[model samples]
Target chain A: MESVGELGESGVLGRVLARMGEARAAVVGPGDDCAVLRVRGDAVVTTDTMIEGPDFRLAWHDGFELGWKLAATNLSDVAAMGAVPTALTLALAVPHDTPVALLERVAEGLDAACRVLAPGCGVIGGDLGRAPVVTAAVTAIGELEGRAPVLRSGARPGDVVAYAGELGLAGLGLSLLFSEAADADGTAHDRTIAELWARHPEVLAAQLAPAPPIPLGPIAARAGACAMMDVSDSLSIDADRLARASGVRVRLETERLEGAFGAQQGVRVPVDAMLTGGEDHGLLAVFPADVELPVGFAAIGSVHEGDGVRLDAAALEPRGWDPYTVRPPGS
Target chain B: MESVGELGESGVLGRVLARMGEARAAVVGPGDDCAVLRVRGDAVVTTDTMIEGPDFRLAWHDGFELGWKLAATNLSDVAAMGAVPTALTLALAVPHDTPVALLERVAEGLDAACRVLAPGCGVIGGDLGRAPVVTAAVTAIGELEGRAPVLRSGARPGDVVAYAGELGLAGLGLSLLFSEAADADGTAHDRTIAELWARHPEVLAAQLAPAPPIPLGPIAARAGACAMMDVSDSLSIDADRLARASGVRVRLETERLEGAFGAQQGVRVPVDAMLTGGEDHGLLAVFPADVELPVGFAAIGSVHEGDGVRLDAAALEPRGWDPYTVRPPGS
Candidate 1:
């Protein structure tokens, strides 16, 4: 296999660019100084970075899965804005010894994710450089299509709090990996990966390559969602954020969460997992009580006149991932 | 000084976001899923990455200069599209033990670059993560304001090729640093950086924080520029790309290059540096022979119905920096 060092920058770049399909809104795509996009309305831009060791383990994540997760995570942010994702710009830097095929797979994954999750959204323009580890940054751009952006601060009292897409399966998948596929020191290995996948395919898929309901973002906005956010760092943590942003209290009902997410894709997900598991990439939205919930969204909570988040009658502490403070299980 | 690990992610983010000012096109700024921008016309997007060892040396570059360079490089891409740069999204990942002040300085520099280089442009949205090295990716967005984008393929046989902003100085600065400030093993040290700056401030400034003629992009477009591109990888390399893209030959006059850029900002630059020096971040544009050159643009060459780039009568070989193939003088 040829490495990036052997193939050189331009050769690797050509292979990566070849895998990228054209975005519908891209007037001029990759190879230019900038990709020109035809904006239908307001433009929404978001950026996210994923680094090896801290963000993902090469032992556990295939290049394709890593790229897919990168695209999915950024695309979820655009969706949370109630916008139609238009394009993505990826900045990828890896060690010189890294395989050129890894980058090609990453590009294929990025292209595949865009095609499957948000059609018409594709890789536009980006730069490739050298880093000590696999460092990928994706900036997603979306169009509001003339509707007002659904902001986290837009929810009010009497608003119905809803959830869409997968909930806790991703977190469960991660837990299973750490427990079954890693050593006591938390060094990840692929010894049990195939077996883990075979036994927990749904959870593994949710964790490795999440397919959030991206189209539902604009749909929720058109259906009159008052506010929305991507649930990345657990439902409880994000709910607390939305509550604080909107200056209201969010009360999540236990029965509703269990009933709606108890058995997702044939996996029994506990209520605790739904509330505390991270990397779900699902949407949490608020709507007026008088309006009907969007097709994919399920009512799980309500906004009230107070502050912070509540599970049943108890105060829910916001806790999940904090990049600076948290380390992976071991190294 | 407090480290990022000590302060945690949110605390570090708060300090960084505090330094960002609002962009004129920003409908919503930081502290959201995405920053929303009011687009006036077609939107231009670009992304660039900078890694610690490969792109810069922390011992030599202050955090502010590093951040400023990051913003400047990406903004040049937007400007090359004949668009008014409006916002930047910065994805920054640093080691856990990095000083919080470094990040603060980085944000301040990003804000200052926008204020000084592009008045209405500002940092809008991005994420912070953890990495083994300091990795930053910036995505810049700009608006065309209804003007047709001046693409690299638009140059005609009779078009005049012009260069704007600093040329050759940045490459000279890099050479100076490698020769003087770095140890025998190419390990950078600040032992003589102050003295070097005192003697060669012009070259150092040009290399460290280039102030490319950003506004000249739209001005040149309005003044009838037929083709435009940001000169990032030396005059010869980028001009060859432009020539090939347009299916025309670009003949650069040695006398014109020396006359216009030989002594820029009180620095004596050689013709070789002007042709082969990289990271100038200047604009190279093509205009109709009959059209008047924009104020900051200097006519340096002309286009002909041929292929590749030429200097006077000889074909010029395209050579500059290739990230993968080239290493610093030593380790």
Candidate 2:
């Protein structure tokens, strides 16, 4: 029951550092003024912010899951750049009354994500602060390993648009959670919700802790990926971003998208979720037209000399999860 | 004035990108999944966070100044490692109702800091989100330039401790501000504080926008510094940190400390502030006894075989700004 205020900053830091083992890229790790890392060739850096209210509901998620999501969100960007994740730096601002045990769980989650998703990558540096709400700011650094970065601007007209990892499962999971909450009345209790959640573990995991295709980034780059990005927002919205950046248009076949969404049993899969559901953390990449598709990638669309994203000859609206417009579920 | 809610996330991001300009180190800047930077050799990475309530007060500091301080706090860490700053990544969480113009000012401040303090170093990437309070998390990347980083643990018993830049000035500035605020009544106005502030421009600048001795970090390393770190908290506190890391005791001379104090005519200088007041962003370094002190650095203490820090043959208490215990002035 002891909170972070009782445990103190140094105590919390000691727990975090203990969870994060030695990093291969780090010459010097935490406790130093700056972490010294070995950077081979170009270094790719990306940063992401997740707030308690807008990004997650603490009632539905624990510190461990939050930590994994934070790492997934940042590492997914590193993977999108066609680089190998080398190191990470985290800045956490939490309420003074937050449980130190919760923070330790968060550290465990971050460490587990790094170990499972991007092996050898570790947290090199971080900061802890007191705040009203829990906020995580993660920066992921990656090594290019002698390959040119697969930028979003490199998509040519004749490129083949492909994706690695689940597309709309996270969105479906979120929808399920929302529906479950809405159906709850005065009689609903934690026990019933737990039973309900137990029935749909896969969908909840996709929403709460996405396993992004981190390793496929380098593989796609080696296979001559023309352009690449992580599908953090809506598939349509992010695809439109790639199209605009590359000065071309992306056209997705409905049948192909349907094929990707095979055997949806309990949850009713919404088509809009597949197109606009964000937080999937999947890789959306464009490869050379003649290049062999990477092992994990499946062709979902194609690029042409036009603007914007289209589906079945119809222009798709670039709408996704806009944090400003939508309130966090249960908030 | 238009608020960030009206502008939306992408609209605000576009404005921020327009202000960032081109970065020398980044092959890809903002508007992408990741920013790719050309890393020469080894990379020095550090991260720091500043929250509105604890780290800073909006009533006392504006967005532009807050931006600069955020950069200074992170860049100073890079300087402690004896590296050349290359790029920075920022993650900002602000209230949705925050003024768009204020965010622009924040961007201006970030740009000005990079232009003035560390030329060629730029903000390569950043993330923005909605939160209850304004928070800035900054991660600075630096190149070691083929020199081994001066770690805090490398100090020897015979090492001479030196400091670059002002000591205890920022804390003094905070004290001045606090006193002025406390003295204000119905009769007291802005004019009275301005009059009080006119007497100590140096101290105010040191607190509001500290120009840390960043260049001195590399210079000290090249000059064979045994250990180095930025004086972020208090002189004694940071010195104690260096001592603990090096497993040695640091002894400071009273006369030498007085000499560093120079002439304090307008305001009475507190000895405790001089020893324990932090936020100075000064460089605390240890060098071989025979090595010539680098330009702009003044010898302050000597390292000896023992534990903890001492002044004039007595143990010095490691008291400084601990964010967990102290509230911002006038909060």
Candidate 3:
């Protein structure tokens, strides 16, 4: 296997770029100093980073899956803004000894995700450098298409809170990976990964390569969503943030959550997991009480004239992953 | 100093965001899923990454300088496309024990660069994560303001080649640091950085925090520049690339180069340094011979009906930094 150092930057870059598809809005694509994009309306931009230790483990994540997750995660943020994603710029750095094939696979995965999740959206520009570990930073751009952005602060007291895409399955998948595929000391390994995947393919796929409903963002906006945000951290944590931002309280009914997300692809997801599972990349939205929920969205709660988040009549603590404070086991 | 791990993600994010200034084009700033920008015309996007060990050493680079360089480099790329920079997104990852104050300084530096280099451009959104070393990836977006982007392949025969901003000073500074402020084994240290900075302030500043003539990009476009690119890797190498892309030959005159950039800011730069120096972040442009050069630009060469690059009829080999192949000493 040829390493990046052996093939050199240009060599690896050429191969990696060859795998990328053209973005519909890109007037000038890669190889130039910058990629020029045609914007129809207001532009929305978001960025996210995934590092080796805290974000993923090479032992469990394939390059394709890593790249897919990177695209999906940032695309979800764009979707949460009720915009159409147009382009992604990636900044990837890895150790000198990293295989060039890994980068090619990553590009393939990124292209695949864009085609499947957000058609016509693609990687437009990026940079490649050397690092101590695999590090990827993705910046996604979206077009609002003449509509007002669905800000988190727009939720009203009489709005119905709804959720779309995966909810707790991702968090459950993460738990399963740590418990079954990791050593006793918490170090991740692939020794049982095949067996684990064979037994629980849905959870593993949900965690490793999420396919968030990207198109539903515009649909929900058109359907009269009052406020929206990507449920990246967790339903409870992100809901609390939206509630505080909107000066309202979010009351999630247990029955609604279970009814909507209890059995995702044959995987039983408990209400607790739905509240606290991270990396779901789903959309949490609020709409007027009179408005109908979008086809892909299910009503899970309601907004009330109060502060913070609640589970029915009980106050729910906002607990989720904090990058600085949360040290992944064995990392 | 309080470490990031102690402050937690949101706590550190709040302090860091407090230091950022507002972007004029921003409709919605940080704290949301994405930053919304009211773009006037076509948007140009670019991304770049800097990682510890390979890109820079903490011993010589203060947090502020590192952040400033990160913004400057990416902004230069946006400028190269004849666009007015609008916003920046930074993805920063650092060790858990890293000081929170350092991150605050980084934000301050980013805000300061946007204000000084490209007013109205500021950090809009970003992500924070944990890594083994300090890693920063910055994506800059610029609005073309309805003008067609100046591309590298637009140069034609009889066009005059020009250069603007710092020429060889940045590369001279890098050489000076490696020779004076680094140990024999190539490990960088700050013990002698103060003395070196005092002796060669211009070069050090050029290398550490280049203020590339970003405004000149739009100026050149308005002045009828046929082709343009930022001189990031070296005049020789980038000139060759422009020539190849344009399907023409670039003939650089030594006397013309000496007359324009021999004594930039009182530093007598050798012709060789101007040819091979990297990280100048200057604009290299080609304009019709009949058009007047932009105020900050000086003609140094001319396009010919041939291929490759030349120096007064002598063939010049293109040479510059390759991140994967070039191992910084002591790193």
Task: Summarize candidate 3's per-residue lDDT along A1-331 as a digit string, tens digits.
Answer: 9999999888888898899899999999999899999998999999999999899998888999999999999999999999999999989999999999999988998999999999999999979999899999999999999999999999988889999999988888888888788776777899999998899999899999999999999899888898999998899999999998999999999999999999899888889989988998999999999997879999999999989999999999998754334444444
Tens-place lDDT digits, model 2, residues A1-331: 8887788778888877788767789898888899999988899999998898788877667788899999988999999989999999888889989988888888888899999999999999888998899998999999999888998989888889999987888877776666564333312123334754688887788888889889999999988998999998889998998998999999987877777654344455566778988899999999988999988888888999989999989998888865335433454
lDDT of 3 by residue, B1-331 (tens): 8999899888988898889998999999999999999998899999999998889888878889888888899888988989999999988899999999999988988888899999999999978999999999999999999999999999999999999998989988888887787776777889999898888999999988889998899989889998999999999999999999999999999999999999999999999889988998999999999999979999999999999999998999998754334443344
TM-score of each: 0.97, 0.94, 0.97
Q: What is the TM-score of chain A alone in each candidate?
A: 0.97, 0.93, 0.97
DockQ of each: 0.89, 0.89, 0.90
What is candidate 1's TM-score against the reference?
0.97
Model 1: per-residue Cα lDDT at residue A116: 97
Candidate 2 chain B has its poorest 10 consecutive residues by lDDT at B182-191
Query: Comparing to the true complex, what docking class would candidate 1 get?
Result: high
Off by over 4 Å in 1: A321-331, B321-331
The CAPRI category of model 3 is high
